[model samples]
Target: MFKIIDLNTLGLGQEFPENIYFVLRGWMDSNNIIIKGDPNVIIDTSYCKSEKETESIFSFCGMKPDDLDMIVNTHNHADHTGGNNKLQLLSGAKIAMHEYDAHYVNLWDESGLNLDFSDWELPKFSVDNILTDGDILSFPPFDFKVIHSPGHSGGNIVLYDSKYEPLLSGETILNGDFGSVHCFREGNRALFDLRDSIKRLAQLPIRLILPAHGGPITNPQKCIDDCLRRINILIKEPIKMGYHFIRRWFIHAVLIRGEMEREKLFSHVSEIENFYAINKRYIKINNKDLFNEIVDDFIERGVLVDRDNRLSVINP
Candidate 1:
């Protein structure tokens, strides 16, 4: 009977009880769920920052270090599986995850380089068993089916409880917005496929969603619509303008101001990248051309006025 500790913001850290414990805010904290069963089960060990944090979590739950049964990962992202090694060691639990992310888990060094690797150092860890879609993990009295909803990542899987009719889809169907599909290195098809996957989930009777980011939504239909809207923008708006057009739009949207100087606009560009979580390196490699094209389109559309190196938004 543990109570939830609110982190104030809806961005990070929070806990909910019901055999399910969402470590971060918005059901996103290194998700750690406890399944009610013969021996009890725990799902998705969180990005354990330190042994002390892990111990504190267990202590708050009135659980001992050696009490965890089964630890599973929704995918191979560091935030989702950062504490695999520590949790397993403390609880003597078996680590489970999609086979596709096995390499990421096993090779994860404490460099914060998994999903949040570029910005944060991810602790190294590994998985013991490979899981797949449609596979049911039984804890007796309750069982969850793995829904292969790959889009955020190749190995992404959402756990569904037939009894509760709820989904523990880490980062698959976030509330307030959809999950970010910015893994350009993984290929654009992955992002496009995500659109299809969410549409399929929209048909389900899921009442509650446990997403990796943003708040959990009781209204599955609304959540699905929100996801569709965000994704459809990628398909409809981005495509209409082409990759280049979108890039320029981002630049003008972020960097340009009426009659702003080049240096000021350039600084704004950096701010835009941060706003969209766009990496400078990635923009140079994959999106530079597309970004420039988008800028040109913005110019043609009268959305922006680019003079020499100076730029500013035009009245829409």
Candidate 2:
């Protein structure tokens, strides 16, 4: 059984990047990046269940939602793009996203945006400017070169600040792992694409990589190398890839909710098998069964512990 690792344990706190007002998020939220500048750009506002919460998040960073001038999305994921509409409406900020990924956001297509997996609804947000690779965003504080790193999702990007921090790799490369792929969305193409993206980013002279989750990566090259290794493993062992997806989902779910009734979690998991585990020719697995099997394995390996028919991470 592959050991299930908790994101919190992988190191979430203790990171303070100078170029950003990093809002480390909990509850399946992407780590939000706020660049307080003349233009005041906010990348990946994360999943705020309410506007008040969103406003509070900005307030904590000593700003209001209306202070933002631009909303730059790293990808089309709900966690990354969820707060675009609310923030834009409040601040009148023009939203910018990769032209390739903007199509789904512009259309507000939940399925295409992969919002179908989210329990919370993301309000429709439109893009005002379409970004391409090599686009330079010059704000008063700093300039960021948009690097289109499409692998985790179509149009996923890494904002590279050459003069300062290297990259804001949104869901592209976390500490010891990368983002999960939805076979239902891109089939096996996602894995192949992810491998290529990691290869390209690995060549950069990077010392810091601020990911959308977990924390900032100090040894970026090693992390990038690890990401490539994981991608290769997934491509070679497809069923193990399915295990990876379900394992992360359950860990995140339990992390957010503390614990859940085993049967209830399994039933809910069964409801969304096709979202991450179905691609007739490429990926085919009943996530419900896989999820159950993963749980037993986790318990056996002490990654998780079962109590009163409820499941939770051992020390999370």
Q: What is the C-alpha lDDT of each candidate?
A: 0.59, 0.73
Q: What would the TM-scores of all predictions be?
A: 0.67, 0.83
- Candidate 2 lDDT over 1-316, as tens digits, reads 1111222343435333443566666646777777776788888877655345656766666678898999888988776777887888888999999998899878878777776764445788788999999999986456788988877788888888666555789988999788887654676588888888888887776757878887667788788888888888988988667666656666655655558899887776566644244422234655555666778888998878999999888742
**Over the stretch 1-316, how does candidate 1's per-residue lDDT look in tens digits?**
1234332323323322344444542122354565544455566655445445655666555677578777777777655665677777777788888877665556653222334322233455667878877899886655789887777667788888767666887767777455445444345686677887887777777767776654456677877887778777766644331342224235424432346654665455444432233433333334434445555677898867878876666533
In angstroms, give how far residue 47 of model 2 lies from its true place.
1.0
Best by lDDT: 2
lDDT of model 2, residue 85: 78
Worst 10 residues of 2 by lDDT: 1-10
Flag regions of model 1 displaced more than 4 Å. 1-18, 22-29, 36-39, 107-117, 237-316
Give the poorly placed runs of model 2, Cα more than 4 Å off. 1-19, 117-120, 252-260, 274-276, 279-288, 297-307, 311-316
Total clashing pairs in model 1: 26
